[model samples]
Target: MDIHALKRQGMTISEIARRTGHDRKTVRRYLNGDRVPGVRKRAEPDPFDAFVDYVTARLNEDPHLWVVTLLDELEPLGYAGSYQSLTRQIRLRGLRPACTACAHVTQRPNAIIEHPPGEETQFDWLELPDAPTGWGFPTKRAYLLVGSLAHSGVWRGVLSPSMDVPHLLAAMTTLLALLGGVTRVWRFDRMATVLNPVTRDLTPMFAGFAKHHGVQPVVCRPRSGNRKGVVEKNNHTAAQRWWRALPDGLTLEQAQASVDAFARRQDERPRRTETGNTTAKAMFAAERLRPLPPVVFPVVVAEERTATRQALIDWRGNRYSVPPELAAAKVVVQQRLGADTIDIATTSGTVVARHRVVEPGLGVTIRDTGHVAALEAIAMASAPPGRPHRRKERIPPGPAALRAAQVLTGTGQPVSTVISLAAYEQAAKNRNTLR
Candidate 1:
C-alpha cells in the first residue's frame, strides 16, 4: 500500500522510495508486485490434464459408467490424481454426455420425515445392469433386495435370481434376518409383486407374510421415493460404492458375504441424530426391533428351466443333470421353504431329480449316476453296428428299380447303358498314323 499506492498516484519510484525512506529497488520491487494478494494462480499444472483425452474417450464410450470405474482405469495410466479431482475435471469439461431419454430431473418441496426407533423399515429393489454373464444367471439384470432401518440408517442387501413374488419374499426374509430383526411397519414403493400398484392394497400372499411376521405394510405414494429417503440414499451408496467395483469370478455366496461386510462396516460411520453425532451401530443397538418369526414364511421359490441337449438344466449358475429323455424339454425347478435340496420336477408335479444346493456361480456341474447310466444305455441301444455309409458315394439305379420305374410309367421301353470303344480305337489309330 505504501510504495505501490504512492506510485499508482502518479509518483515515481524514486519519489516514493525517498518519501517512504526506502531504497529505489525496494520501491520498484513493490511496484513490480512480486507478492500480490487475491490473485488466483495455479502453482503447478494439473496432472489430470495429461489424461483428459483418455478420460473423455472413456466417457463417450459409457456415459453412465461409474466414476470409480474411471478411476480404476486411470490409475495405471500414469494418472496420479485423486478421484475427486478426476470427477471435478470431468464435470468442468463436460466429458460425459447427457442422457436425454432419462431426464427425470424435477424440483419439488422436500421435508425431512423423521423415523422413530423401532417404528419402520424401508425396502426397495436395486436392479443392477451388466451383471456377470458367466454366472449363468437367468437374466442380464441382477436384483438386490435392500432393507434399511429408518432410524439408524443400518441396511442390508440380498442378491436374488429374479423379482418374482416368491423370490422377493425369500430375499426379504433373508434381509430381515441379516438386519437382526423386523420393524413394526414395512414400507414399500408399490412393487407389483408385493401389492397392487393402483389400489395400493397388499397382495394376499404378502399380507399373509406380514401377518406371519407381525409387521404392518405401508405403501408410499406414487413416485414419492423420497418418502423412504434413508433406504433411497442407501441404494445409491450401495450401487455406486460397492456394486460398481465387484470383483470378477466371485461366487454368489462370496458376493453376498462381501456386501454384508460392506454394510456392517458402514454402520461405524458417524451419523447425526436427535441428541448429537453418533454412530449407526450405537443407535441401532438402542432400536427396539421385534424378534423374527419362529420359521420363515412358506414362500416356495419355483422357476421353469429348459434342459439342454446334454440333459442338463441351469439353476442359479449350477448345472444339474436331468434324465436324458428330458433333454430339449421344459422342466420345473422348485425349492421348498427350509429345504437343503432343489427339486427338478415335471409339468405334472412329479419330482424327477434332486440335487443338494451349492454355492451359486461357481460353474459346478452336478450329475446323477443314474441319469448318466440311463443316457449311456439308450445311446448304446441305438448305436449302429457298422461304419456309416459314405456321404458322397454314387448309387446308380439297378434292374429292380428300373423295372419298377417302367411299371409305374406304363411303358416297356428298354433303357440302354454302354461305353463305346470305337472312339478310343479310332483315336489310337490316328495317333499311330501321326507317329
Candidate 2:
C-alpha cells in the first residue's frame, strides 16, 4: 500500500522501493496489485490435501458422522493431523455433504419469536434409547416428557416408563405441577399420542384431555420445529448433560428425582435479555400462568405388575398387598391422577386390592389388615386339619404298601398291619405315676 501510495504521488518504482525498503520488482508487484499483503505461496506441498479424498468419501458415506469418530478411523489409516486441523479443512472445503433429511434440524434461516408471559408452553418427548436395564420397564427405550414455559424458559421433565397416551397424560400432569401452572396454549410437534400426524388433528383422547385441562393445543408446522425452540434447546441440554453420564443404580423414580433436581438447579443460570441479565427463576416467578384445575384430566394410567409369592405387587418401588389367591398372578395396577389410593385389579378388571398411596422409592411394603388376616388363615389352613401327623407312631403299612408286600410274598391278598401298643402303655403309666 505504501509503494502504491508513493507511485500515486508520481515517485518512480526505484524511488518507491528505496523508500519502502523493498526491491523494485517487489514494489512493482504491490503497485500493480498483483500481490496480496498477507497471502504467500506455501513452500511445501500440503499434507492435508493427501487425505481430502478419503475424508470426503467417508463423509459422503455418512454426513452426520462425528469428526472425532472420523479421526479415529483416519489415524489407523496413517493420516497424521490434529482433530482441529482436520475439522477446519473439512469446513473450509465444504467436504461434509448437506443432509436433505436433517436440513430442518441443522441451523438455517429462521426468525426469532417473542413469547408473552403465560401465553404458551411447549412439550416434547425426549426418547432415551438403550436406557439402563435396571430402569425396570418392559422395553429398553425410556421417555421423558419435558415441559418448558416459553416466556421464561423454565423447564421440567417427567421420567416416564413409556411414551404411550396414558403415560403421556400421567407425565404431563406431573410436569405441569412442577411448572407451577398451565399456560394458555400448549405447543407440540405432532406427537402421535396427542395428535394424529396423518390428519393433522388432535387425537380424540388428547382432545378430551386438553378440553378438560382448559388449554389450547398448537402443533408446529410440518418441518419447523424451531417454532417451539425453548423445549428443543432443553432437550439437547438434558440429553447431553444429564443422560450422557447418568449415575448407575438409579431406578425410574430415582432418576425422575435426579432430573427434576437438575432442572431446578438450572434456574440459577444467568440469562441475557434486551432489558438486562436475569435468571429463569426470577422470570418464572413473574409468569402469570393459570392455575391447574382442582382435578387432573381423567385418564387411567395403568401398569401390569406380577404379584409376588406374598400376595403383594411392586409399584414405583413400593409393594401393595393383593389377595393371597392372586399370588404369582399378573394384575393390573391403576392409579388415577390426583387420587390418594392405588387400585390393584385382576387382569379381568376385578378390583382385588386398593392401597393408600405412599411416596415412591421408599421401599415400603403396604399390607391391609384383611389381606394379612386372610394370608395368615391360608397359612394355617394348609396345616394338617386333624391332629398333627405323628412323627413316630406305632403303625405298619396298610393298603398300598402292604398290598405290594403281599404280592412280593406270593400271597395275592392284602396283609394285616400290626400296631405296637406296649411302648405307649408304658409311657401312659409313667405319666400317671408322676402325676
Candidate 3:
C-alpha cells in the first residue's frame, strides 16, 4: 500500500488506493508491490525421477546389491544421471537400500489354521559353514534342525551333520520324542532328502521320515522361501541370536551347546509375532501334536563292516582296536560324529571302548599283550629317588698325559698282558684309578 511501492509496481498511488479501497496517504505509506504475499516459488524438477522408482524396486528385490552395481544397471536403462544425484534421490525418499521385496500377496483369510495344543508344527534345516568344535580337535560344520509349533512357537532345534534323510529323520524323531508326540502336520521345504526328489508334476513327501511320525508333510513351493516364511525368518533370527551370539573364540560344540540353550530360551520367551504370548503356554494349549507310540527308533546310525584279524578298525582312518571278542568276526559300526563321544562296539552292541574321538589322529590300539612292563618302567623313572648318591670325586686324566703314558708304555703282545700291567698299577695305588 506504500506510494513508493505502488509507483514502482507501475500503479499510481491513487490507483492502488482505489483498488485496495484505502486512502491515498495509507496506500503511499505501505505500498511495496515488489513482493507478493502467501506464495512461494517452486523448485526445479527432480533429475532422476525417471529411474528412481526402478532403482528402488531393484534394491527391494535384491537387498544384497551394491549402489554402484545398481547405478550400472540404471545407466543402461536411459538413466542420464550421476551417482550423486541417484544417491540423493534415494536418501530424499527415505529408502532402505537393502530391503527385500515383500510379496504383496496378503495371507488368505484362513491360510493359517490354529490347531489345538500339539496339533501341528513346522520343521526345517539351516546350513552353516565349517567351524571349530569346542569339545574335540576336528572342525565340525553342522546343520541346524529347527521345529516350531504353528500356533505356539514352542520349538526345538538340534544340530546334525547334514540334511541326509537318515540324519534328518533321526533329528526329527529325536526332537518329536523329546516333545512327546507327533503333530498332525509338519511343514517344510522340498529338500531332496525329505522330499523324494519331486519333479515338476510329481509331489513326494519323504516316505520313510513321514511314516515314522504319521504326520502329513506339507511342502512349500520350490524357490519360494516366502511360502515357508515363518521358519525362514526364524532361521535368520537363529543365525543372528544363535550363530552370531556365540563367543568369538568358542569351538563348534561350545557354539552348538550355546545355540541350543539360546533356542530353548527363545522358545520359552513370549513371541512378539504373537502379541507377547509365550510359545510354551500356547503350545501347551494346542493338543494337536499327537503322542508318539511306545516304540522308539535308534539314533545311532549303523553301518556294517568286516574286521580282518590284522586289519585295525580304521574309522575315518583313525584305528580302534576292538577286543579279540570280535577279532575276525564282522561287526556293526555305529559311528556318530557330533552328538556323543566315539564308541567302539562289538557285533552284539557291547561297548569295547568309550573313548572320545579327540584329534583326527588318536589311535585306540587295544593290544592283547598288556603294556604293564612299559608302564612300570615309566612309573619307576617318575618315582621319587630313594636316597642321594655318595661317590668319591676323582680328577679325570688330561688328554696330553694319557697320550704320553700310552706312547711311553709299549704295546703289549696280547690284551691279557696289557690288562695285567694296568692291574699292577691299580694294585700299587690301592685304588682303581685307571678303572
TM-score of each: 0.62, 0.65, 0.51
Assess each prediction's global lDDT (C-alpha) against the native. 0.86, 0.88, 0.62
Q: Which model scores highest in TM-score?
A: 2
User: On residues 303-326, what C-alpha lDDT tens digit does candidate 2 reach at each position?
Assistant: 888888889888888888999999
Clashes of each: 0, 0, 21
Worst 10 residues of 1 by lDDT: 100-109
Which residue runs of candidate 2 sit more than 4 Å off their true CA positions?
Answer: 1-107, 130-135, 373-435
CA-RMSD of model 1 = 13.3
Two-way TM-score contest, 1 vs 3, winner: 1
lDDT of 2 at 121: 96
Best by lDDT: 2
Question: Candidate 3: where are CA atoms >4 Å away?
Answer: 1-66, 72-86, 89-103, 106-112, 133-141, 197-205, 222-230, 248-253, 271-279, 285-288, 293-435
lDDT of 1: 0.86
Candidate 1, residues 123-225: lDDT per residue as tens digits?
A: 9999988788755567888888899999999999999878988998889988999988999999989889888776777888999999999999998877777
The lowest-lDDT stretch of 10 consecutive residues in candidate 3 is: 99-108
Query: If both were scored by TM-score, which would come out higher, candidate 2 or candidate 3?
Result: 2
Model 2, 26: alpha-carbon shift in Å?
A: 26
